[model samples]
Target: MNATGAWDRLEPKLAATNARVAALESDPSRRNSFVAYTMERDSAYCDLDGERLLMMSGYSYLGLAGDERVVAAAKAAVDVYGTGNHGVRALAGTIPLHEELEAEVARFAGRERALVFGSGYAANVGTVGALVGQGDTVLIDKYDHASIVDGCRLSGATVTRFRHNDVDHLERRLKAAAPTGVRLVIVDSVYSMDGDIAPLPELREVCDRYDALLMVDEAHALGVIGKTGGGIEEHFDHKVRVDVKLGTLSKAIPSMGGWIAGSHDLIGHLRYAARPFLFSAALGPAQTGAALESLRILRREPERVTHTQTQAQRLRTRLNDAGISTMDSTTAVLPVIAGSDDAAYDYATACRKAGVIGLPVVTPAVPNDLARLRIAVTARHTAADIDFAAEAFLTAAAQTGLI
Candidate 1:
């Protein structure tokens, strides 16, 4: 039964996705998703499929993806420490670079200490499972990252999801929960799809009232917000307390791995207790070195954060002014609503044909009627580039009959 009946039972569940993929792949102009980059010209542009399209879908928000300094650090680390570590970090995997990277992350995030994980997904799942169990309660945003949702499911904690960005709904749920075990409220600092920010101050006030610990994932917020790219704290210029702060290194840091920053005691507990950290091999030296260097650059040149946000608004405005709905985005990410799954595919196909590479987010990632093209504008995209991308998007919308 295990061998013969597995796919037979599972294939039906995938029929819709299969059809969507078939339609998506049928387009001759579609080439963005899952394509390997042969070369990167800079932070703003990459060479793919024998063409150099303007990139509107990358996560290097601070323009440091191919910075000479970052590349140099990664190369130097490989020369000294070689390619990989010996074992799991608990045993022989830890390196000087790992310790140095953690310290720098803690410093940059204004936390007492930091613990690094093999990946951001690991950080969330492992930390959540380590922190809570039966009888504990966890509340999360409806639109948080999938990793966060998986973390809650695996934690053995009773999970409650509140409406997206509604603090009042959260308060009501908190009031109704049993007042015995730990209550943790988690959210993303900057929502990945909608690109709106979490109301940190409001969340802190509500969490404090309920004695609930607050956690915020900075995956999309770290390099896109803040005055000096200081993340949620800087974005609001408010001294809100976030008990558990976790984020990924792959996005703005332009490297691999992840880190959880918090009080020294929390870091100490997670270092020894988190299963993902305990079981997985340590982060590679090159990734650690690259992240460290990128962070240093972010510290020295915060204006890049401002530039990225400005260009994002510039693009958002252009699209909105053209009567296209961007749907509540106010950060470097702009969600260009495309109506439905088929419409999203058509929009992306038309978009690629016009020499821009913005990808689509269709159901069930988003509601069917709200399917969209998620365009993330990074730093180093000049005003001209932003204008060009905007016009290209408008043209695609027209071609797809979405306007």
Candidate 2:
């Protein structure tokens, strides 16, 4: 055995994954099904390899990604602010646009203040690591996004996982292993992979009883929930809830970055101590400007939210009626559980062949046993598009023996 001989040991695992990829690439029907590349947008759909594929994998829940107003705002900011923020926020990155965006987000979420980060992953890891420490107990949902889980681990907190959306399990854990100092209970407003909503009301009640601070990552719920699109707290009509609310500007706001909406003190603390925010360069002028415009649009055009939910429900209904399994998703995301990883990839390929573009969620992003074909419904998708995708999925699933 030589120094490079160790590489031979990885052959088995690599071979397995390579075999899966090979199978996906081998099938002609699946080969042209889903393409991984960019396309030129013309009207509602895009031109992909000369075929107009109905894009169903976009996360622009409010369909503001290509809004003229947003584009103009971003461009104008680029011309005026001249691109980058130029430094870390603590140094020279903080600008008027960042301040304004933070203020707008905090107001939208009904919080006293907000702190902005380069991305949602940054916000979670930074806030979690900053707030909770070695002695604290962080209770996380099993199905929470990877960022939340990573944040807990990075915080050096004693992390305990609870069953997804199981309030009883949460309460039991809280009672049995309550933190001697600070207890941070974290969950996603909507489970990103499954599209199922967390039991916010129950969770909030439990947190109150345990005297724990509640944190919610509303990445999927932001643009798709609440009367004002404030996310799960608003969707469940929880008054004065969520000690910390995390939102992503990229999804609903049609720009980039993440924000934490909370008390003035919390925001102030993270501004000074959060590792990512302190060390990372702040969002550039264009993103900040576009996000501000998107936020304004969301506030003014509340109909976007209504349209998104209606569209999601319609698509979910159509998919279910087509004999395809759509998990218990109440939001814009719909996942087709494919018993195994290969099956999930096959389903994704089928959707692509049918002119529907979706993503495959497989291990370790999702549990190996819970691999799924993830579909995101946008407000821009029409009844015709939904019908086409539903029919295509039906045909592909039947052909692939997925159903």
Candidate 3:
């Protein structure tokens, strides 16, 4: 059948969803504030048609997205190692650069060993699947990343969810599962959407009491928290030996890839057993080189990490002062709750219309009543730029009757 015909068959179901979105758009509290367009971007702002607005929609929390140093390193690696690894990592793709990047990530994360993967999703899937199996139990935060949930599913393990950041609920669930199977608790160090932090130390203590191995995904935490950018484990000053520390290089590292930092034995096992590692191409030379360079910069310039947190706090405080809902965040991610999916999308569009590109997160990314404008602050934002963003958001919210 033709693509049109295939789509026609599914249109009814999709139209129902569209109707709900449209209804939300018509809401008096959101109608006046919506954007619809393509945007051209610069270093810290994007041009929405003819208007220039501060850019606040990126995961480039360190403003290293297009840094000259990282770019030059990538180009040099391309010249030296070409564009692709050309084979799976176990084959002819394993290069010296990959080894170097892995070592740097492992050291930076304060772990004895690390294994690089194709992406953060790949790391979670491969590692979690490898570590657990059928009959084992995996306890995850309700707001955990989708990748972690999929990982649990692929592992053939029974999955259970506790309330978001609720240590009591986590403990209750963990204790309930203790007598049944091998237990694993996985949580994001800093939740990607809600902008709230996980109570990692409390969770760790609960896990210890139940003999469950604790896993922490710092895809949004690394490079933005901890004294050395080690993430929530470092942020809370809790030194619980995280059995698995998963992170992504695409964010703060300003590169593309992921890593699992853990004990040497565990990493070595993933090297041999993880299907993603065995089947996926090795990290490209340019990506590996750029990530390595970024890691070096992170270690050498700890100020960059501190600056990101300070910027986040500054922006969060400003938004709060302006009567904008920041959703209890204390990290680089600041969420402006819009209450409904349509409202969230409209608010994001309105921000774009005002010249800022802000990301609107809605279900199934977040629960249905918690749709929000997920803004990731970076050290690259100046005080003036922050003020501009805050004012624009407040204006947009007021115009839409959101505030």
The most accurate candidate by TM-score is 1
Output the lDDT of residue 259, model 1.
Answer: 90
Worst 10 residues of 1 by lDDT: 30-39
Model 3 CA lDDT for position 274: 85
lDDT by candidate, in order shown: 0.89, 0.84, 0.84
For residue 159, model 1's alpha carbon misses the true position, in angstroms, by: 0.3
lDDT of 2: 0.84
Candidate 3 local lDDT, 218-249, one digit each (tens): 99998888886778878888566677899999
Give all TM-scores, in the order shown.
0.96, 0.92, 0.91
Candidate 2 lDDT, tens digit per residue, 246-283?
99998878888999998889998999889999999999
How big is the positional error of residue 303 in model 3, measured in Å on the Cα after superposition? 1.3
Candidate 3 ranges with C-alpha deviation above 4 Å: 2-42, 48-51, 178-180
Which residue pairs come into collision in candidate 2? 33-352, 33-353
Order of candidate numbers by lDDT, starting with the best:
1, 2, 3
Candidate 1, residue 48: how far the Cα is off, in Å: 2.8
What's every prediction's RMSD, in angstroms? 1.7, 2.7, 3.4
